[model samples]
Target: MGVGGIGIWQLLIILLIVVMLFGTKKLRNLGSDLGGALKGFKNAVKDDDSAKNDSTDENQPSENTDESSSETVDITAEKVAEKAEEE
Candidate 1:
């Protein structure tokens, strides 16, 4: 009357055997390591998604390109003026 046809007592006995084979400390360490690995994998997936979004945004044309190009021109002019002043 437990999980599937295996009774609660049978499950408990298997759990006990496993615990006896591997001490409590080892089991705790293994559980934490598995949790850490899952957390790291989640973070990596998030970063990859954000990178893909950024690349797609750059690939598409936007209204800001003209403004950005003008800004670049102004910066170049300023640098040229500074060099002329230095000379």
Candidate 2:
């Protein structure tokens, strides 16, 4: 089908209805409010980026472990197999 199944005539009709209902003055105020909201959102995003760049210590862990970690291996497969056979 067409995009949103709406023709140019249908869009024009909808626009006419909106203009009649809200009028030019209300539409102007709505446009200004939308512009201000978008500007505020952009400023908020920029502030977030600058805050992330400035505070490097906030991302780092405060404590470091002094103890050494060791790995151990066990070879008890044969014993486990014998126990399974007895069971």
Candidate 3:
């Protein structure tokens, strides 16, 4: 009548057997490791979301567009010089 037909008593028996086999210390260490792994995964996901937001913000037009225009001009000059040298 429980999960997949396994009752609460059966689940308790399984947990007891696992504790007996692994000992309390090993189980504690395993729990902590699992907790740390989940925490790290959460932080990574948060950082990825923030990075995406930052990229979108940068793509929007701003008043300081002159800086970007100067960079484009520099790139164009470099390409023109390269073409002249190839001629």
Q: Candidate 3: what lDDT?
A: 0.93
Distance from true position, residue 45, model 3, in Å?
0.7
Tens digit of per-residue lDDT, candidate 2, span 24-47:
999999999999999999999999
TM-score of each: 0.68, 0.61, 0.69
lDDT of candidate 1 vs native? 0.92
Q: How many backbone clashes does candidate 2 have?
A: 0
| Model 1: worst 10 consecutive residues (lDDT sum) | 64-73
Clashing residue pairs, backbone N/CA/C < 3 A, model 1: none
* Better lDDT candidate (1, 3): 3
Query: Candidate 2 clashing pairs?
Result: none
Best first by TM-score, ranked: 3, 1, 2
**Model 3 segments more than 4 A misplaced:** 63-87
Instruction: List candidate 2 stretches off by more than 4 Å.
Output: 57-87
**TM-score, predicted candidate 2 vs. hidden true structure:** 0.61
